[model samples]
Target: ANNPIWLIRNGELQSFGPDKQPIGTHGGEQNPFTLHEMQLEKGDCLYLFTDGYADQFGGSKGKKFKYKQLQELLLSVHKQSADEQRRRLDETIENWKGGLEQIDDILIIGIRIL
Candidate 1:
């Protein structure tokens, strides 16, 4: 992806002991995307997502959907229209989470090159 890497964390919300690592410390990489210098010709799209969207648990007793499932969902909808892709992604997350509470804030963005 050519888009900038965005990081989000909430230390106040995380529950961690003094000796243990913080919950959100591993949110993202320290550096932004290295492709910032690249220029897009046209008709390029980049999508970035956070784990919150895929880590959600639901179903009968609740279970984490995991990253593989999220990647598959993205690949399946990769060729669809941008709007449709977003809609499908949202729907998939909602369906997977069911009534479970969201564990963390989710951030996803789609950028279209012009």
Candidate 2:
């Protein structure tokens, strides 16, 4: 997992803090994720993901899909469109998981610079 950041209107740091320290928003009650403004001139891409994708189980016999594998997969399909990237990633996960039941919610967001 990664800490999400945002940049809106004049690069204002609209981040919340508690006790003068960077804390979750809404009185430190919510962990909000945001992608304020994306800077993609062209031929650029961004991949955001949650832990469930790597925590999945199934492969050959049955094993957790490690982060390394996910990174490799992303690198392999980095050239595809956002939609295509999502499709391929989902397909890859499904194939790796085979018939294993999903353990948790999986979220993957891909933004292509176009």
Candidate 3:
């Protein structure tokens, strides 16, 4: 599934955009990417990521990690420091992907408005 920009504000998790790949190597007359604009307040957290994390095939029974699980994980850690959040995310995914080769590149950028 395509990845949506995840935002956490006032302890709520929200998702937006991702109509298509943000960047594509092949140039074509495809519909222009949608521009998303929003107001972020102090303590709000935003996450931008590639689909690899959620698309990863892991965990017991070797199932996909899935967006719902990823959402829950993010919500649980949005309140932590950036470094801690990074560590937890890394550890969790690694543990989940144990003994399996990674399926794709994973990139997650998390920002906390101050």
**TM-score, one value per model:** 0.58, 0.63, 0.92
List candidate 1 segments past 4 Å from native.
1-44
Model 1 over residues 8-87: C-alpha lDDT tens digits? 12211111112223334466554432323334435454556556776688756698877667656655665578789889
lDDT of each: 0.58, 0.64, 0.89
Cα lDDT tens digits for candidate 2, 18-60:
2323443445555444425545456555555566888999999
Q: Which ten residues in a row have the lowest lDDT in candidate 1?
A: 8-17
Candidate 2 segments whose C-alpha is farther than 4 A from its true place: 1-41
* Residue 2 C-alpha lDDT in model 3: 54
| Better candidate number, 1 or 3, judged by TM-score | 3
- Alpha carbon lDDT at 9, candidate 3: 93
